[model samples]
Target: MNPTIQLEQQYLVHAYNRAPFVFTDGEGVWLQDDAGNRYLDLVAGIAVNALGYGDAELVQVMQAAASKPLHYSNLYHSQPMAQLAARLVQVTPFAERIHFQNSGTECNEAAIKFARKWARSHFGEGKTDIIAFSGAFHGRTMGALAATPRPKYQDPFRPLMPGVRLAEFNDPDSLAATIDDHVCAVIVEPVQGEGGIHPATPAFMSALRELCHRHNALLILDEVQCGVGRTGTFWAHETYGIMPDILCAAKPLAAGLPIGAVLTSGRVAEAIHPGDHGTTFAGGPFVTAVANVVVERVSQPAFLRHVSETGAYFQEKLQEINSPHIIEVRGKGLMLGVQLDMPTAPIIQAGYQHGLLLLNAGADVLRLIPPLIISRDEVDIAVERLTAILTKSA
Candidate 1:
C-alpha cells in the first residue's frame, strides 16, 4: 500500500470509500499520484475543480487574501463579498439578492428557511411544506436533508423535519399532485447530478414554474453540480428558459474553494428581513474573492460557448463508442452520465487503472463532470480510455 494512503487511513474517519490511489498534485486536467503516475481527471474533483487543478489565477487570489485576513464574521461587510454579490445578481436574470454560505448544503438550508419564512409571513405557519423530488440530494443538514427525497440518505435519520413532500423528477403529474396551496416551495435540479445526470424536460420545468406561481410557492433550483458553466450555460435552468425564484449554487462556484450562494428573485428577496438567517462563514472575504474570479471566468460568453462545444463533442464521442455495456448516454454540457448494464464500480476501477479518474453517480451510472475548460484533446483522451475500459468490462 502507498505510505500516504496508509497514513490517511490511520488518521481520517472511515466515512468515505476512497479510491486506492493517492493524488499528490494536479495541473490543468491531470492529477499526479504519490508514485508519480498521472491520470486524466475527468471527474474534476466531482465537478468542483472547474478551472482544473493548480489554476494560477485562483491560487494567486487565495494567496493574496491569505496575506491579509483569513475570515471575518458575517456581521461585517467586506469588499469581496459585496463585489461577488453584485456580480452574481448582475449576471443572473431576475436575481436581486444574494446570501452566501460555505457549502451547497448550507445554501439549500438557507433557501428552505427563506421559503418557510416567506410563506409564514404571507400565508401562515401551515403553509410551510416544501416539495422536493425523488432521488434529490440537497445536503446532510437536517433542513436540507428534509428536502432531499432519497430513502437511503434519509431512512437512517428518520423523523426529519415535517412538511417536506416528495415529487417525481421530470414528472409534472406527480409534482402537480403533491404541490398545493400549503406547499411553501418546490425545489428541484434542472439536471439531477447524483440522480444519474438526468436533465429535466422543458415541459416539466415550464409546468413547475406555472404551478409554483399559481400556488404562490417559491421555486428553488439546486444547481450545485450543474451550474457554473458545467452545463454549457451559467445555470442549467437557462436551457429551459425558466428562472427559479431561489437558486442554490456551490461546488465549482469558486473553482474548489468552499463557497455557496442562494440567489433570490426580488419578490422572495423582499420577504426575508435581516436576521432571518445567517452563517458564520457565509461570504467570507477570502472565499468570496476567489469566487469572484471564478464567476468572472465562467460567466463569459466565449467560455460558455466553449463549454457547449466541448460538451457536444464529448457526447458525440461517447455515443460513437456504442458498446453493448452502455445502457444509455444522457446529460448536457460536461455534466454527462453513461448508464451501464452492470454496476459501475468495476468500470470505475478499470478507469483508475487506465490512468483516468471518474465518478459513479449511483449503482449503474458513471458520471463525467470534466472541467468546462478541458481541451478537445483531453476530452478525446478521456473518451478513448473510457471506451477501452467499457469494452474490456463488457
Candidate 2:
C-alpha cells in the first residue's frame, strides 16, 4: 500500500472513499499529484474552487487575514461580515439579510429554522412542515438530512424530522399537492447538483413561487453547488425568473474557503428574532472578507455573459464527441452533466487514468463543475480526455 494511504487509513475516519492519488498542488486548471503527474481539474474541489487553485488575490487576502484575526465570536460585529452581506444584497435580487454558517449543511439548518419561525409567527404552530423535492440534497446535518429525500442517506437515520414531505422536482402538480397550510417552506435547488445536474423548468419554478404565495409558504432554493457564477448567473434562480423567499448559498461563494449563507427577503428576515438562531463561527471576518472579494468578481455582468458563451461553446464541443455511451447532456453554464447509458464508475476511473478528474452524481450522470474561470482551451482539453475515456469504457 502507498505510504500516504496507509497513514491516512490508520488515522482518518473511514467516512469518505477518496481517490488513490494524493494531490500535492494546484494552479489554475491543473493539479499535480505527489508523483508529479498532472491532471486537468474538472471537479474543482467539488465545485468549491471558483477562481481555480492558487488564486493570488484570494491567497493574499487569506494570508493577511490569518495574520491579523483568524476567527472571532458572532456576538461582535465584524467589518468583513458586514461588507460581504452588503455586497451580496447589492449583487443579488432578493438579499435583505444574510445568516452565515460553517458549511452548506449548517446553512440549510439555519434556513429550516428561519422558515419554521416565519411560519409559526405568521400562521401559528400548525404551519411547521417543510416540503423538499424527491431528488434534492440540502446537506447532511439532521435537519438538512431530513429535508434530503434520498433513502440511501436517510434510511439509517430514520424518523428524522416530522412534517417533511418529498415532492417530485420540476413537477408542478407534485409540488403543489405536497405543499399545504402546514407547509412552512418548500426547499429546492434551481439546478439539482447531487441528484444529477437537473435544471428546474422555468414553468415549474414560476408555479412553485405562485403556489408558495397561495399557501403562505416560503420558497428556499439551495444553491450550495450551483451558485456563485457556476451557472453563468449570480444566482441560478435568476435564470428561472422567479425569486425565492430564502436562498442558501455556499460552495464557491468564498472560492474554496469554508463559508455558507442564507439570503432571505425582508419579510423572512424580520420574522426571525435574534434569539431564534445563531452560530459561533457564522460570519467570521476572514471567510466573509474572502467571500466579499469572490462575490464582487463573480457578479460582474460582462463576466457572467462570458460564462454563458463559454458554457454554450463547451456543450457544443461535448456533443461533437458523439460517444455512444452518452445518453444525454444536460445542465446550464459550467454546471453540466453527461448522462451515460451505463454506470459511470468505470468511465470515471478511466478518465482519472487519462489525466482527468471527474465527479459522479447518482449512478450514470458524470458531473462537470469546473472552475468558472476555466478558458476554452482548458474546456477543449477536458472534453478530449473525457471523450477518449467514454469511448473506451463504452
Candidate 3:
C-alpha cells in the first residue's frame, strides 16, 4: 500500500473514496504526485480552483494578507472582509449584504436560516417551509442536507429539518405545485454539478422567479459550484434574465481557499439581527484578500468571454469524440459532464492510469470541471485521452 494511503486509512475517517495517487503539487492544469508522476487535472479540486494552481497574483495576495493577520474573530470588522464585500458588490449586481462562512455547506446553511428568519418576520412562523430542487446539492449540513432530495443521502439521517420540500429541476410547473404561501424560499442550483450536469432553462428560471414573487417566497440560487465565472457569467442566473433574492457563492470564490458567502438583498438582510448567524475563520484577511484577486479577474468581460468560448469549444470536442458509451454531453462553461451508458468507475480509474485526473458526479456521469484558465491545448489533451479510453473500452 502507498505510505500516504496507509496513513490516511489508519488515522482519518472513512468518509471519502479517495483516488489512488497522492498529488504533491500542481500548476496550471497539471498536477504531480509524490512519485514524480504528473497528470493532467480536469477536476480542478472539485471546482474550487478557478485559476488553476500556483497563480502568482493569488498567491501573493494570500501571503500578503497572512503577513498582516491570519485570523480574527467576527466581533471586529476586518479590512479584507470589507474590501471583498465591496468587490463582490462591484462585480455582481447583488451582494447588498453578505454572510461569510468557511465552505459551501456553511453558505447554504446561512441562506436557509436567513430565509426562515425573513419569513418569520414578514409572514409569521407559518411561512418557514423551504423548497429545493430534486437534483440540487446545496450542502451537507443538516439544514442544507434536508434541502437535498437524494434519498440515499437522506435516509440514514432521516427526519432532518421539518418543512423542507422538493421540486423538479427545470420544471416550472413542479415548482408551482410545490411552493405556496407556506414556503419561505426556493433554493436551486442553476447547474446541477454533483447530481450530473443539468442546466436550468430560461423558461424554468423565469417562471420560478415569477412564482416566487406571487407566493412571496425568496428565490435562493445555489451557485456554490457554478458561480464565480464557472458558467461564463458572474452568476448562472444572469443568463436567465432574473436575479435571485438570495445567492450562495463559494468553491472558486477564493480559488481553493475555504470561503463561502451568502449574498442577499437589503430586505432579506433586515430580517436577521446581530446574533442570528456568525462564524469564525470566515471572511478573514488571508482568504478574503485572495478572493479579492479572484473576483476582480474572473469578473472581467474578457476573462468571462474566454471561459464561455473555451467551454463551448471543449463541449464541441467532447461531442466530436463519438464514443458509443457516451450517452450525452451537458452543462455550461467549465462545469460539464459526460453521461455514459454504463457506470463511470472503470473509466474514471482508467483516466488516472492514463495520466489524467477526472471526477464522477455519481455513478454514470463523468464531471469535467476544470480550471477556468485551462487553455484550448489542455482541453484537447483531456479530450484525446478520454476518447482513447472510451474507444478502447468499446
Residue 22 CA error for candidate 3 (Å)? 1.2
Candidate 1 wrong stretches, greater than 4 Å: none
Off by over 4 Å in 2: none
**lDDT per residue as tens, model 2, 1-394:** 8899999999999999998898899999889999999999889999998889898999899898888787878878799999999889998787789888888988889999999998888888799888988889998878999988888999999879888888999999998778788889999999999999999998999999999999999999899988888889888889787888898989988888788989999999999877889878888888888998899989998888878888888888888887899878888999999988999888878877899999999999999888888899989999989878877774
* TM-score of model 2 vs. true structure: 0.98
Per-prediction backbone clash count: 0, 0, 0
Question: Model 3 off-target regions past 4 Å?
Answer: none
TM-score of each: 0.98, 0.98, 0.98
Order of the predicted models by lDDT, top scorer first: 1, 3, 2
Better of 1 and 2 by lDDT: 1
**Where does candidate 1 have its weakest 10-residue lDDT segment?**
68-77
**Which candidate wins on lDDT?**
1
Q: Which digits, one per residue and each the tens of the lDDT, describe model 3 over residues 1-394? A: 9999999999999998999888999999899999888899899899988998889898787777777878887989888889899888777685688888899999988988899899989888699889988887877779999988888888899779888988888888898899889999989898999989999998998998999999999989999998999988888888888989999999999888899988999999998898999887889888888888999999999999989999999999999997899999998988899999999999989998899888999889999999899999999999999999999874
